[model samples]
Target: LLLPYLRNKGRSERVFKDRSNPLEVLSEKELLEKFRFPRHAIQQLAFDLEEKLRPETSRNCSIPSLLQICVVKMDFFNISGFPNVIGAIDGTHIRIKAPSTHEPLFVNRKGYHSINVQAICDAKLRVLNCVARWPGSTHDSRNLVNSQIHDAFERGELQGVLLGDSGYPLKPWLLTPFLNPETAAQTLYNTAHAKTRNVIERCFGVLKRRFHCLHGELRMKPERVCNIICACVVLHNLEDQMLEEPALEITEAGDEDGSGHYIRQMIVENIFSA
Candidate 1:
């Protein structure tokens, strides 16, 4: 049912014809009879799988492993002329059903209900960290600031700088592009920053393209939606590590909020200008 549904929704192409697989040609009633499970039971099973596979930083990640990731990403950026870059950070909105309470909080500037999911990805297209509990109304910078990854960086527990876009603040630990590059050096810096930060955009694209549920509206509750998003991210990372092929190619949606624009400009002028 899921396979036929994905193909019908135009999320993926049919891999097998009706003649090749009798199951693929079965009617909905026939399929249901073969499965012998109710719709609600399938949903419950999905939820159980999500809970079992969702990524937990403490359980799935370690300091030594993180340092190894940093070293690999740093080398990748170094070849591109961006020094000490560990990861690319960005946010994408996941559409969800409107909530019963505080509906306005879920409606984003695009006039849709969603959850803003922030993720940091390494050069290898692996999700190093993810935060998916924030409402779509929340700014990307605020979500980052409130995340455990931010606290970790603040405590100097992590090494190297993160490459972000202009929507994020420029800190000693994080680098954002120059808003208006007037000089050749600033132009060069902005070019490098954009090129390096684009990895996160591609990461999101691959994730959404692989998970059709995320590409379309998720009808589940907000909390359940968050769980599904995290579960998908964990699965995406696993697939990337295993070098699995992607199902489709999807473009990324762009977002911009000037939460730390002023501070970013100051850092660019004081440091990058020199």
Candidate 2:
């Protein structure tokens, strides 16, 4: 029901009515009759379960433990021919219904209402951190600055650098790709950066593929939508750890902001020129 509803909410109610029991398919009508409950009740039960089972990131990866993540990530990057990388960070837009108030703020550059969800993922495609509450109009850099990861790094609670796209700022703890490459070493740096950063893109693809609800426009309030996103992230991480699924292919996406361009250039010279 969740699958059908998420894929096409308008046609879901009629879907279960058309299938037969002999075909090993129970129509929506049959399930409804057997369960003796309305469709809304079932949906509500699923949401309740999700909320109850939502995994807490702090339990698995606390502030102090983040340094350990840095160690693991650096080793992972070494295997991939990149160095000193802790995690890959990026933001994706999650479509949502326009709110009654401040509806314009929810409209993104793509002219759709959404939530700008920022996430940091490790080499194994596990979501290390997620921030789902920001409106679509919020820039990726702004979201990063407000994220718990950023706060932890700022307070010296976490160590190592995170690789991001050009959309993010380049600080001592955050590294982004070069805007343009005029030297062979800079070109090599960009190549390695792209390869290492591709993990976050694959992570998003796997996440959206597993949870169809995120593929379509979420028909809930912003707060509920954020909760659902967080729940899905928890489930994705659990599945990633437990299942032996095939690897996800890497894909590329562009970034917009360059607030830390100068900082990025300085770091690029220091690392790649050596």
lDDT of 2 by residue, 1-274 (tens): 5897677856545454555432145556866777765566656656655653554455544343554655656655774566666678899999999998789999999999999998878787877778888899999998877766776776766656678888776676777776878887788779888888998999999999999999999989998999889888767866665685422211111233354466556556776676
Estimated TM-score for each candidate: 0.69, 0.69
- What candidate 2 gets wrong by more than 4 Å, as runs, is 1-61, 64-67, 243-274
Q: Per-residue error at 271 for model 1, in Å? A: 12
Superposed Cα RMSD, model 2: 10.6
Residue 60 C-alpha lDDT in model 2: 48
Q: Candidate 2: which pairs clash?
A: 16-27, 16-28
Q: Put down candidate 1 lDDT per residue, 162-272, tens digits, no spaces.
A: 888778876777778767777866787787678778888989999999999999999988989998898888677656645653221111112333534554455446545
Off by over 4 Å in 1: 1-61, 65-67, 244-274
